[model samples]
Target: MLILWICFLRGARPILFIDGCHLSSPYKGTLLAASTCDANNDLFPIAYAIVSAENNENWIWFLSNLKELTGSISVTLISDRHPSIIAAVEQVYDRDRHAYCYRHVKENFCVETKKLQRGIRGEVKEDAKKLLDAVCYTHFGTEFTKAVEQLRAFSPELANWLETKGDINKWAKSQFPHRRWDLITTNVAESFNSWIRKERTHSICALITEHRDKLANLLYIAKLEMTKWNNEVGPKIDKILMEHVARSEFLKAVRYGDHNVMVRGSNVDVCVNLLRKECTYLEWQMTGIPCPHACAAIKLLHSNIYTYVEECYLKSSQEKIYASSMIPIETHDMPDVNNLTLTDWENNIFLMPPTTTRSLGRLCKKRRESQFQDVHVYKCSRCDQSGHNRSKCRNPNPEKI
Candidate 1:
């Protein structure tokens, strides 16, 4: 399997989303990856290493290498609450620098609560989940404490699990010691695994080679699109700014001083400081872009709203991300080094099938998915319905059910 990471020595954020995905058949190992988003908010791979398994020793070695690469630059690592990962991050990085994935935390809580609160009313269970969400997402200490207490009131066991199992300062955005640039999950690394899914079954050499080519193509395509951006910021950031602008029109701004202003919305009144690019809402701090309230304040001063956006979202910064060039590989008309040249690798290396006795039921065709993930439904051509394909479809007619 192939693992990859984007170079964060320049325009990328100091935060990285790290995770491991299991390799498929013919390869017995795991691909440990660390990834970051570029200025345009696109996933950029830095480096990757393959290991025999996801264990403490392997994870430490992998993260220690990351430490060396990041040299003196304190960085934050985000991922699920995996025991090996938590232990390894603590050894290789600062305890404060390691952050847990909020999705994983929430989903884990949901799954565990169901087991713990068996036979509980659905309404009560749902209300407990809402309270947990507030606890996980609240930006203020007072709000956080109140949410936790409310959660404890409804489901003390689940609340205890959250506090004892994970640290609030690590997962909560309002509490993180440093800026994560809104990267709260390991989904970027998971996406990398899915991108290289086709290569998982291949030999290590072939997989690595294909990954190199794939990275080159991805960079080349992004570089081409960079030339087409017409605004001060990249397309997506510009779109975000436009959205904020639209939302700002509905709110009212009250000037406190040159930059300090109070933005009052229907639900809440937020204090916005255009000079510092800050808002009481905290979205400005997380995303590095002015929230709608901040935008409303910016509009009051008649300042160019584009200037309020972070430098990382600027067009120049996005260009810097793709400034490096990747050398092309001449794979065509190359020397035949496979079966034709010698005996054979793919053909000669044959293995026997499993020797286990056949089971009664049909063999499972798809991999098991995580409970948090949404299951994809396939439509059947024969029945013109969802959940099954034309072949191996149970119902042949649409109305036959």
Candidate 2:
């Protein structure tokens, strides 16, 4: 827990990903975890606890401990729409920001769409799904509205169902707060859970020990890797910036007022304000990285573009996150206690295992497939390739039918 706090405080991002995974141990506890993305967009486990169950009380306990660990720092939390988690977050960190995982929301949307599909015809549901995807990824209010309207055209009932779920701002990128950056999913925490899947079946104390060892090794390697980075920003951010710079070549920039420029794309013109580090397209603000429009404006200014990137993506901040090393607990230093009686050890030193009731079915490790698991096959019309469509087909010539 001390190491968790140290890593979190040293990092520049004030974002947290909270989630719970069911433990496969005989105790059958729920492992509540909070994680974050490091400078390289890798999972950085912050805190975790094993509880008997996942409910309001357990969630509150976990979050309360987390609050104590993180102090009063303002943070943006991302998680699935679990009622217990929602209640606990509101109770513990009322002033902090919260965002739902878009993947979970999309799964729920698919379930509801299927319920509505009983009345609608074929392709309408598919079109609605595509529209929902568009809505989730759109970085501008107008684009989101356009996607929603398109969904409404396919099935007003499905659109209305989505509205009833809650505010679009909670799930849509265009409407989400810029503080969350481009993290719309709780994949960081999910990845952490998968990484610890094998250890999750162990006893509580053993599970915690495994977590400590794994994180210690992970941070040590990360520290060594950070020493090799020469870029101002981390490698991930540099790659993203270079891609944006490449795209900026096609954009034309016209200087406007101080710190403001108009970037003309093939179809649209976006206003880029270097002073505010924003673009009319909203991608720059949403991602904490310069978009193509902002890239064009920065090129015109002849400035170091990486300066516009958020501090969380910088190499210095990344080095700070891995500066602390986790000291290994040496077992050889402990005094020999083999002479102690079993009864005395049980009464004074040994702790009892948690009581647990075995569930009915055989223990299963695989997750059930959701309603969105249907596979869609693509075939090229030009060369009859199975994996690609005609527009993207690599074949230069095709047989005439």
Candidate 2 global TM-score: 0.86
lDDT string, candidate 2, 62-95, tens digits: 8898888778788888999999999998899853
Q: How do the residues 229-348 of candidate 1 rate in per-residue lDDT, one tens digit apiece?
A: 888887778888889899999999999988799999998898998877888888899889888998888888988888888988887777777777677667686545552533444464
Per-model CA lDDT versus the true structure: 0.80, 0.83
Which consecutive 10 residues in model 2 have the weakest lDDT in total?
348-357
Which residue runs does candidate 2 get wrong by more than 4 Å? 119-124, 333-348, 358-365, 370-401
- The count of residue-pair clashes in candidate 2 stands at 0
Please give the distance, in angstroms, between residue 383's alpha carbon in candidate 1 and its true position after superposition.
14
Error of 1 at 242 (Å): 2.7
